[model samples]
Target: MRTPPTIPAHLPRLAARFDLSSEDLGNCAERCAARVQRLADLWSHAGTPPGQVMRTLRRTAKRHSVYMPQKDSAAECINRMSDPAWWRRALRKRFRAVELHAIQTGAVHRHASPYVSAKALRRHELNAARLAAQMDGLEAINQTTGEAVPMSDLIEASLANPANRRAALMARIKGIETSALAKSHVGLFLTITCPSRMHPRHSMSGAPNAAYDGTYPGRAHAYLSRVWSTATRRAAHLGLTAYGLRVVEPHHDACPHWHLLVFTPADQADAYADNLRAYALADSPNELGAQERRFTVKRIDPAKGSAVGYVAKYVSKSIDGEGVDFDSESDNDGRAAARRQIAWARTWGIRQFQFFGVPPITPTRELYRVSAAGLPGLALPELHQACKANDYAAWLATVEAHELRLGVDYAERESTRYRGETTKAISGLTVEGGDLTQPLSLVTRCDTWRIEPRAKGQAQAPSERAATGSDFSPWTRFNNSAPIDAKGLFPSDAPRAKTEKKGEEGETAVRGSVLHRAPLPGAGRGDWESARPAA
Candidate 1:
């Protein structure tokens, strides 16, 4: 026997907002069709494009034809109209408001007149249906579990905090000194890692092992630090005058892995790579006595989309009873004893455990069902209101109103048996940072840094020696043609500032008559006019 589908809990609110009965919905469809036909007739009489007029007429006819019968008939009666045309038409009328709004607001293409483009209608309908299905699936899950799960909960659980991610990325950029490195068209980063193994008994009994005494991390942190410092001192020897480095410990497989971000000239990259490898291999493990250690080095380019999210995932204790147990053995006697020990351990109850990185907080199906149950036959306005109120329950109500207003005939029947298409249209945009799942439009701007090999034909200037404080002035060059302020301040919009220029005798002397600003501003300073000028 088949069970009847229950109306969602938000149905009452949806019913109140919209006249969504089967008969009234049918009337609305008829009215929309009549209006479309009228527009088409008027366009034809006024010498509108034949293609545009015909397209509108055909779309209106199709939408009305499918929806009229669906609203008037029972679920079984509408179930019979399960053809592609019926499904498409029903969807078009369902999202008619969205298409109309898109055209009116000029957000979509200018040619996308609701009366002239069936394509626009088709797009809105398809998007709405897909969005509805996703919400429905979430709702079904929630209902099964008899709980309420909000969309915010899902976002918070699956994604990292945006602020933290942004701050870390900005800090990395600041260390790279982007302005200086931009001229060379290269970015460099230093990477470091340490791997160690722990004995089961040593960790369990709190005893120190010879190889890893829970001290010194079993790897050579001190050695790497010394080597890095020395390398920085000799940076100019390797054609690397400007650089930046960051040391981070990533969580992976219940262990820590050292990660470094280094920047250097593209030409000197190979030298830096070679030196780091040699240093790592030559160093001895701290706790492994005389055993030599080795490390891996990989060069990454941000322009080529090589950088991935640096979230740490360590193999720590599981929130649930799922993880490696060092005491378990494969031998028959050992396995039997291990099983017995596990049983005893389970009886003693498990302790509260937390992982080092972000934890999983995805909502269950039951919560969505509870949320969806409250909403039925909601219209677009009601949906907008619900979103404004931050009420998921009201949002579901709006969805239900739309479904009912559009008529449940074709959608209900097709939804029961439909499988989604496998093909997808390609999006022409390319994103440089963040995970693929992140929305591309949400990205405001990309901070670009480059690393390219110095061209072979480009000769180094005779005067172009290693960088010195005198070679690069503290103040940037500024144009003096613009008007100065009352306090002798340069225009705030000046391109550059004047500074002490290096003379042949290595003596610092003012080279230009342009004015400059002090690093800090004085009191009562409002604009360039009120600010003090540099000496």
Candidate 2:
């Protein structure tokens, strides 16, 4: 007879803790039996007997409170329970509680939460408290910074701040204005194209990838840098010591381009443009090289408010296939050619550079303060004064009439609609004829007025007809003939007059008699009809 197998050492302890009713134990035994049979099949494939597999399974399951009623069931339970799904689900249910306990107890590891030292637990709590205090302090500081600070103030301050890298730039711009190199100035946009092409290794010929590679600043970037340096040097020579410039690299069809902003005098615009072009193309020593390459420059008008937007587009754009028209065969060819050109451009030994002259460093502090004061509250009184002074009262009356006709809530209307600040309301009172002291209504009067329906077949009244010239006398010769009936001389029934007409004396003249025709009014014949109706 076979010897009874020895129970695993941990089985007895597990059985004591998870003591179950016989019926429940029997159900577990049945599940374990099925598991054992499956394990036997698996292990036997590798030449291990079912009994040996059962022995190994029994040892494994005992540690996890999994019980096997028999040797065969041991293998079955081990095979089936090896999947930790049940344990994972159970852990998920207590995840939050487990995390909290781990924090409170200063647990070092997930499986050893109950074994943390008291010192470790206190350390974690202190660290948490310190972090909370830091966050609160940060919030308080943020609140005290004030919300009314203008964006212009922030930008100006950021540029002029001593610790900022742009401090030198600020100084340069300041020098230009103070030295009288430039008077009232405007900004310019410089577009520089590089002769260098992208390396063939990175070229995307087909779809025209617009992506830029930071690792490879490319010949375009190098060329831009040289142009910037040259331009700055030239500006210094012109007595514009303080100049500010921002150079950005842009990619088109895989080739690089530079976008630049500079501040200089408006009157010297032409000179600046010429000098910039010369400096940018200065790289070509020979006629052929100079003829083959060109640098493009454009001035940015600050009044247009598009300089910032123009710069941002190239900086943030990605070289995705989105903007490309892949359907066109020419586009594909162009892209391929561009990639080759990029590689060729590299041979020119051009490098990218962006430079701008700094604004005056001294005025930065005062300017920052002025900008910081923030925009004034709606200058309603000043606006009113301006309107009165400029005779804008009629305009105000017109606006008021429109508002009334529309039946809109005037008080609730947004000031932007009228191109004014919300804090100010347009007053209905206005001066007539630009007279600040006179009311608009008193300036003009409807001395003669008539109304008529726009619809067809509406009979006009006698007064309305006279007002409309319907009952007016017509032009007639002085031969003592019956006075030409106005209606007969110009019948409404006739076809509409041609837009073009001719005059008498064989000279091309306009038709249509004046209410009182004379030798043309400007001929110096004073009131021709009053002078000679018989002529």
Candidate 3:
């Protein structure tokens, strides 16, 4: 968590003098001077190395060399570095140390606070970046396997193997339906496409078919911005309240395209397609060929398709392909070129999976899911507030108040057989909530719950009413866990079952068939994939 700003003693008077909001004070991380000094201190002679020193000197020389200070020796450099204000100025002029970071809160959870911390770590850019990805929000777990693979990897792998891509996509559709947003609202698979360039266009000198085109980002970004600005306005005219879950994918030659799962009021599905076309054409005149079928909207089927799985797959594609084109038809060379473009974009600091409107899901809905599922997780409001402010003290207070534990711990404790100390195979799991700490026992207290169990040859999920009629707690489900499809997750070897203790409900806890082991090679970090569903 960023350290909170100390409130000025005269803040009440200051606020009255110049109308300010509490959020303004609550949002402040520190007084400007402290931040300046820290970055400035990093550039000091003791702090900066020989390469930085040379770079600084070179930059200084380029900026009016004749007026350069005479401090050239190591001793003189150290003397100059002693001046904090001077280093701050040099650092700002040389690099954007001031523009620094956005400090995206709620992206990650350290022990005390629920927030993400980001910066260019010394000498470990890629590793630091990946570490930061730990804060990316959660998507649905594959219902059959209970595995939480990054959505993009699953989509790409499925698309690449055309023989099974259809089934995989269908599976993703259902998974999307299980999530908070897609479950409640009408989701439409929407595409906003740019005019296809017959050949690569360049602003600077470069070949049309150049592997890494310098012009693609600018052109793609401009087109996306233009269409998006107009599209939202059109949505307003159509009287639709829209929320989008979208992904930006690079085209074959590196131009960008969008894949979107948009949620609007549930009853608007029938009229969406016509309005979408009108929206696309509103800004694009026929003379400019803007009417070329550049927009598409397909209403999601709650029965078999999911908006979450559809859009999430595209988000995953951007990084898994490492920025290569998403098409499966590409040869090795095409794939390589795609990777290069992605790397180049990263080097230029392009954002992947950005948004143009409100996020489709809300934090309250997330917490409710955790609560309804009888899962152990964090208090939603406390976490919600912590994600807003930059108060280190408030972060510490949250940490002190809540007894946070890992999902694994919750799983073990909730196990009927393993409710005490005896060990046995582990079966089944419950994953819920967002990027930060989860509150334990939030949902277990709720009297109502609907649990869907996996059974043989079940195409349609039984109604919610039917689910509540059975014993569907983790204990019962894990004990009776059965295989549903090929997507089922299981350890390579199955374990034998044993006896267990009884719960307060007087039901005997059967030993489980699933057990936790390290994930297979290339599995997600710290994810429990070794334990497959009970067969």
TM-score of 3: 0.35
Write candidate 2's Cα lDDT for 445-485 as tens digits.
00111111123433344345447654322111111111111
Worst 10 residues of 3 by lDDT: 98-107
Instruction: Sort the predicted structures by lDDT, highest score first.
Output: 3, 2, 1
Q: Pick the candidate with the highest lDDT.
A: 3
What lDDT tens digits, residue by residue, belong to model 1 across residues 352-457? Answer: 1111111111111111111221222233335434432323334334444344121101101112222321212111112112222322211111111111223344
Q: Candidates' lDDT values, in order? A: 0.30, 0.33, 0.36
lDDT by residue (tens digit), candidate 3, 387-471: 2321222323443455322232222222221112223222322233443353332211111112222233322222432364421
Query: How do the predictions measure up, each by TM-score?
Result: 0.24, 0.26, 0.35
What are the runs in model 2 whose C-alpha is more than 4 Å off? Answer: 1-186, 197-215, 218-223, 240-244, 252-256, 284-294, 299-355, 360-535
Model 1 RMSD in Å is 32.1
Ranking by TM-score: 3, 2, 1
Clash count for candidate 3 is 13
**Which wins on TM-score, candidate 1 or candidate 2?**
2
